[model samples]
Structures are given as structure tokens and as C-alpha cells.
Target: MPSSIFINQLYRPPSSSSPETLPSPNTGVRAFHQSLPGYKPSPLVSVPAIAARQGIRWCLVKDETERLGLPAFKILGASWATYRALGERLGLRENGDVVSLQRLAEAAKAEGVVLFAATDGNHGRAVARMAGYLGVGARIYVPSLLDEEAISKIRGEGAEVVVYDGDYDQTVLATKVAAENHAEGKGVLISDTALTVDDETANWIVEGYQTMFDEMEEQVLEITGTRTITHVVTPVGVGSLTQAVVTHFQRTPRSPKPMVIAVEPKSAACLKASLEAGEMTSVKTEYTICTGMCCGTLSAIGWPMLKSGISAAVAVEDSDVDTATKNLQSCGINAGPCGAASLAALESLSSGEELALGPQSVVVLLCTEGRRGYEMRSNSQPEP
Candidate 1:
């Protein structure tokens, strides 16, 4: 494999001042989600062989392949954000009061409200799924590079899919503009990324992702007899999921904070570049095989938390991702490109001196998605 990993240590311990803190995820988010039908925790899987090979004590993959019937973990955030946004609009404030999809649909219809967003694939599909559940209209914008299978999936959920002849950032801008131009009370932009840190919907999106970490806390203890997560490796597109991981570990009262490693495609290393420049930055990117992670800009809503929370950020090539995906397959874990990027980062760090991996370290990789119709491998067979 060609060496294509660039690592940057963004945070160091014994800092002069404390990092900015966000509101902790309350029990209400968990209760609301658990109340929904078919709400089960995704598996926290251990790959002993891979851990042994990497000279680590344990390697856990948070298998989010089938979260809430969605192919990717994006649904966790999208659904939560959608519920909160719609709930506020409908004047439903009490946490104990269950807001059913029927109630949401009736309110949305009466108020002429529609959910809108721009996505590379998974997030848009998730928002569409939520809209479908609520029997509301959904308008999703996608870049020209999105695969046909993903587009079909979004449309299959009864969402109006609009393909933009621009890159992901441009598509996001267009969606934002459209939402602003929509008739009064007709459109609600439920974007995971925004230009402002105080974007309520975007903040809610990050909070929505807290459910995954809550599950991980319980499952990690049950499986490992300890709640300490030494290291976390996850892909960074807009950094929403990564921010959630950082917040969860930082806010947990007794648990030791994990070293967060953010992975991105070499073609779109926005977060890495931003950290290097010491400011929010944007990059021009081409089509990368890791399509889901092809983001050029860091999310304004997520950057502050990621900047202060992540230990390091890495940019890996597409070939590295392919190797990682296959390696994960050998361990019986199916991961899409973006999902496998976490494993690729782990492999890179294992051979380097930047992040230590020893018998005491417990590493958790986020397998954010599974292979849908867009299969990157020829056969689904595992290597011996």
C-alpha cells in the first residue's frame, strides 16, 4: 500500500484553559427514541484477531449498518433533529409527552411545513425517511457525484430528489438558499452543517447523535467490564458524528476521556486543513472513492467542539480505505468506504508513533454504514 496518511495533533493535555462545553444530552432523547417501534441498540462488536494483529488489547466496531432500518448511522441524528424541530413548531414541549408521527403529520399538513436538506447520500435519505414517517413532504438536494443507488433510495422514501450540478458545498449552499426563499412556514432546513455555531437545528442534529454514545456506554461496560474508551477512530465529513463522540466522552462524569482521531479523504481534508491553519478553512476537492466523506468545509456548528476535543486528524487516500474495508470484511464486519476509513486510520496510527496502542488501550471504530446497492467489492467473501 502507498503511504497516504497525514496526521496532525490538534489538542494536547494540560492545557491552559478549558474547552467550551455544550449542554449534556439528557435522558429525554433516549426515552423518546426508545419509545419508537423497532428501536434497538446497534451491536458493539469485538475483532480480537484484528486487535492482536495491531498489537492492541481490544478493537471494537460500533456496527451501525442497520440503525432504525437505515443503512447508515445518520438516521440517529436526522430523526432526533427532525423530531425536536417539528416538536417545537407544533408547540409540544413536555419530554414525557410522546409525539407520534400522526401528530407530526397532521401539524405539518396544517402548517404547510416541509423538511429540506442537502446530502451526499445517507443523511438525505435519513431525513426523507423521517419525513415519510411523519407523512410530510421532503425535498432533498444532492451533488452530481451521488450514485444512482443512493438517489433511488432517497426517492424510494417518497422524497423529491433534486440533483445539483455542483460539488457538495455548493449543493449545501443551494439548499440553504432554497429554504430561505421558500414561502413562509413552508420549508424547514434540517441541515447537519451550517454557517453559524448557534444554528438550533444543526445543534439539535449533534445532540441527536448522542443516543449512539449512550448505547456505547452501556454496551462497552457489558462487553468489556469497563466503561473507559481509550481511543475513538471515526470519519469526519461535516464533523457532526465526531463532535457527538467528543462531547459524550468529555461530559461523562467518571469515564476517562478518549483520544478522538478524525479521518477524512485526502481529497477533502477540510478539518485537517482547518486545524493546521488555526481557523475554519475550505478546500477544493474532486471525486473521491470515499464519496460519503467528500466534504470540503468544516461545519460551523461542529468545528468549535471538534477543534478543542479531537486529539488528531488524519487524511487517507482511497486505496487506504479499500484495504481497510477488506480487512474489516475479514473480521465479518461489513463497512462502506466512509465506515472503513476509521479502520484505515487505526491501521495508520498503529504503525506510527503519534497515537499509542498497547495492551491497556481499548480502541473503538465507528462502522458508520454498510454496503447497500453500491458495492465496492466484487465478491462478499471474507478473507481467511
Candidate 2:
């Protein structure tokens, strides 16, 4: 198998990261192995009782809260794409450190590099952290339901953060407006999902997810002693990380790839509607307990990956998220609404019995983020 496959192709492992093998027009696809060194893998914990009580024997938790000091899965995709996009523009290799992001920000400031994105919590934080570390000024648009603590963390990362009027989907539109209003040139929108391919940032973000699958593969081996994943679940807000998982795993040794499930809130099931409609579509996003799943529109880049028969999208209730949060904590793990959405979907799936939960099949859930989302979970109102 090749070290890395093309963006459209399936997953394959090339030899470990090598400077000579970095993807080039001449060399084809290259792994960004050394591009960002010191990446520690996320731990995959076993939820035996959670699985057993749910009528399944076991479930694996791909805990990503500890990624690069961030408490979410957003960094896996965002950081990978950021470095790759910068590397391409500057003629740098995967092994090359190239120009520091701080220096590039100064130069980019002349040209005006302003990052933009709408998030419930994690995605915006990832963008803010990346832009701050790279020295580029960024304006992150977020919903009113966004946690103050998460926003403060993003602000600490040096991005000018804006709390928009409504939900995550509305914030996405507001962000587009902010990026277009960049008269001083500080508004280059760094969105993860869109139809146009001109911005290579999303693709790079997806690359960051590759390392995630790499970590997941290790966990699968250590826990199961075999790499065959039967079913996988991931929470979707923007779908960048979800798409990356599908893309990476689809290329692996599992020919009939695991049943990839998309977990979203029923109140704002953009990806769910898109899947049912068989196109990139949007749903009427209402204020819900699961603020993260309140994304109104589907990310165009991520939709194609989903529509390719790689996923089974499902809308989960708020109670499941609440229960999952408490469940994770009970198991000594911290996961917020967005992070627990995957497990929530699993519960729904378990009840649905569509995928048939049993001991023979190994289920993997992407515990995407930490309790930084605790502030925004709308427990005051009724469940979704």
C-alpha cells in the first residue's frame, strides 16, 4: 500500500514519513509525517458497561480532548490543513519547517490573511489556535450559545472572536459576511466545508484527521489485537473530521469499511437532511440542547464524502447527549455535548437495531472534545 493516498482515494499506509516521499506534483501523494512533529496520539478507552448495557459487548472511545493542549477533535483536521496550505504556497516539503507562521503572518498581514470560521465551540477554537500560532490575525464567528470559556480560550489564542446572532449555521453566514467585509485584508475565511476547491485549507484539515486514524488504528490493535473495525460513530458539526475519518478508513485493509454513522441533533440535522435528500442541503436549525449539532447547512466539501455511501447519518436526542456526558464522566472521561454526540447516536443506533450490535463487531466512537462545552448545553428547556 502507498504511504498516503490522494484526497479522493481510500486509505493506505506508506512507509513512515520521509522527506523524499512528501507529496509533490512529481512524487504524487506524500504523508505530512514530520511536518508537524511531537504529535501525541489520543487514547482509545474501552466502555465495557456502556456497551454491555446498550446490548453490545464493547465500545471504544477515541478520546481527542488532549490534542495539542486543545480539548477537541478540531485540531486534528485544522492544524494539518493549515500547515499543508502554507507549505504548498511557500514551496516547502513535509519535513521542512519552512517560514515560521509568525513571520508568514507579518508577510501575510501585508497581503492580509484573516482567518474566518463559524463554530459551536471546537472548530472555531482550532482555527483561532492555528492562526494565533502562525501569527495571522483571524476573526472567528460563533453562535450566541457558544461557551464563554471556549470563546475565552480562542481569544487567548489571539483571534478576534465574534459572537453571532443565532445558531452555528447562522454564525457560518455571519462569518461569510465578516470575511467579505475585510477592507483591510485581514479576512481570508478559513472554512472547513464548502463547494469551491480554491481554498485548500479544508483539505489540509482533513489531513490532520489522518493522524487521528493513525492513532485509532494503534488503539484498535492494542485493544482488539486485530484492525477490523465493524462500526464507527463520529459527531458532526462541520463534517471536516467526519469526512477525514471516512476517507482515511475507506482506504484501509477493511474492504467493506465500517458502517460510519453521523451523529447530529434532530433540531438541526443538516447532514441528516442532506443525506436523505441526496444532495448538499440545509435544515431549519432551532435552538437546541446540543448547541454543536445546531448547524443549519451542510459543508459542501464534506457532503460529497458522505453522499458517496460512506456514512449512515442519524439525528440524536438531547437526553442521549446528557446521558453520554454523565456516562463518560462516570467512566472517568470528560466529554461535552458535541463530543458525546457520537455516543448519543450509538444509543439511538442501539435502540434502532439497524446495525445489529453484538460482541463480534467492534464499535468505535469519536469522543471528539472535552467539557469546555458544559457551559452551552441548554438543560433549562425540554429535550430535542
User: Model 1, residue 155: displacement in angstroms?
Assistant: 0.4
lDDT (tens digit, per residue) of candidate 2 on 1-384: 211101112222222213242322211112443334345677899989888877765689998767777887677667656655655654554355545544555565456567787777677788788786666777888877666787888788887888887766667777888887887644666677664645466676666677777778888988988887877888776677777766666555564467677787777777766666667777776666566566787666676556653446777667778888888889878887777888877776544445546767688989887875453345346433
- lDDT of each residue in 126-148, candidate 1, tens digit only: 99998988878899999998888
lDDT of each: 0.82, 0.68
The alpha-carbon RMSD values of the candidates against the true structure, listed in the order shown, are: 4.5, 7.3
State, as a TM-score between 0 and 1, how close model 2 is to the true structure: 0.81
Per-prediction TM-score to the true structure, in the order listed? 0.92, 0.81
- Candidate no. 1 TM-score: 0.92
